[model samples]
Target chain A: GAGVSQSPRYKVAKRGQDVALRCDPISGHVSLFWYQQALGQGPEFLTYFQNEAQLDKSGLPSDRFFAERPEGSVSTLKIQRTQQEDSAVYLCASTVGLQETQYFGPGTRLLVL
Target chain B: EDKVVQSPLSLVVHEGDTVTLNCSYEVTNFRSLLWYKQEKKAPTFLFMLTSSGIEKKSGRLSSILDKKELFSILNITATQTGDSAIYLCAVERRTSGTYKYIFGTGTRLKVLA
Candidate 1:
């Protein structure tokens, strides 16, 4: 892909439901990141991956938030038992390598009703 | 705790008017500052500043970082309606051999025609 891409541009889930969002980074990118953005707020770091290795998971907010990059190219972010507070935009980004500028995807807006 | 802050949560300007956005950060091991323009869900890269006092520019958009002050400013000259969007600032920090970005709550710029 020319740029990072994410699946389910929008999602509406009932409280307590689980939702999974997908991201396809640019070809051969070595680093990927996940973030959550609430209304009128900046994107908050969630997790990071260097290749297939999950080097950092410090930012995941809670046990319900999970992310994985099995192949180092595509990643998935899953939220368990979604809550109304979880309504926000989930963004994915990738960089050619560590310390490089990131390219963002067209975030998935999850609305927990 | 690493944190980023942006000023002027929202701005209203007329076309052809100039605007400046501010970003400040307090973090350990700061590496660089980046600016992004987000019109929808996706935020596109604009500029990256690594050296203090050196301005990085592209056409009507320019940004400068001041490490001593721990802040950066993005200036847009002769703005257009198309330039109306959220401007985000992020700081890259390296810690424990891992890297992450801390973003500020972005400035919402509205250029009226």
Candidate 2:
């Protein structure tokens, strides 16, 4: 079985630019999560979705961050007006249910100059 | 705010040696504790502990949780170079009918061959 997968393993953007990171969760997974990991730090939750419904977005740092899962399988995290502080790895994870074991993706590393 | 802490932010151990990583957390409506192993890219799930006093083992790695104390310990016996990575601890809690995960700073283990 394939695990979670992310696209554009690496990305470089200038300040004030917008960037979008994509994630494809495992098939049949009902829960999806996004996290941001800074250098030498563990991942911090960004948002969560359950079958196309955005359940939680409180972890999102600011209003510039937006995420959506339209079809209940693939998700995208979009950051508007990128900032140097946003330079981190964006990780995606999926699980069978709430509080279940989560499988993570390779992550997309974003660099804002 | 919910918080998770890991001891000995970094450690170095020689092959064949045994090591223990600690994780303690404080959160509202605690649900479960999870461990993950991260190398360069993705963080892979190691174990999920929902009960106290029960130990979960796989190969040379084992983990136990102490719910009453709000902590967990992961033990790696006969460590190998392959065990070199960052070990992350996360706690899950329910908030507003949704679950969120709080992660620790992580313990960086460098296993020398």
Candidate 3:
């Protein structure tokens, strides 16, 4: 229960609609990450944040995908004009330091039709 | 580009059997390698290895890293039914003064009673 938590474990959205997935990392975690896992595949990096500053987002597939961690505690991943290819499990992880073990949330499963 | 590769995509074993999972990576600015076990939801951290030749063990699960060879292995002895899940391997790399993970597709294990 003290681990990372994610909202809307499952979401179904029609194509061209927008969707937002939220992640609440463990208390005091300084590093946050977002990843997308396609069916039967390992998670691919999406973005990274330290405290409230987003440091890397090269993994984002396109400009339509956006993520923010305004206060450094919680993060939100938004996808505009969702497409069928966007259906996957979005996972969030956090750690105390760069080299520390990452703690992962349950992940938000999105299905775009 | 950073990449992680896992071998033997799927395995089926019976109780009391021993299994080994392999992960190989090629990345820039390597930081650490991590192992996680995923069931139906979140992936729980199992081990994090930074230095080579040091084996990290917990219960019947153990992992070792070889930075020189750019690979790692996870071994589980006397496997049980509860061990049925996906084992993921991720490599952390420092980029843009931050860090991100490159994950392997994962090895799916099924243990029968």
Least lDDT summed over 10 consecutive residues: which range in candidate 3 chain A? A95-104
In candidate 1, list every pair of residues with a backbone clash: none
Report per-candidate DockQ: 0.94, 0.89, 0.92
Clashes of 3: 0
Candidate 1 or 2, higher lDDT?
A: 2
Chain B global fold similarity (TM-score) for predicted model 3 against the true chain B: 0.98
Docking class of 3: high
Across B24-103, the per-residue lDDT of candidate 2 in tens digits comes to: 99999999999999998898899999999999999999999999999999999999999999999999998787998999
After aligning candidate 3 to the native by TM-score, how far in Å is the CA of A52 from where it should be? 1.1
Best by lDDT: 2
> What is candidate 1's lDDT per residue for B19-86, written digit by digit as tens?
99999999899999999999999989999999999999899999999999999999999999999999
TM-scores of all models? 0.98, 0.98, 0.97
lDDT of 1 at B89: 98
Give the lowest summed-lDDT range of ten residues in model 2 chain A. A94-103
Chain B superposition TM-score per model: 0.98, 0.98, 0.98
Question: How big an interface RMSD has model 1?
Answer: 0.6
- Model 2, A28-88: lDDT tens per residue? 9999999999999999999999999999998899999999999999999999999999999
Candidate 1 lDDT over residue span A1-113, tens digit each: 48888999999999999999999999999999999999999999999999998889998989999999997789999999999999999999999997788999999999999
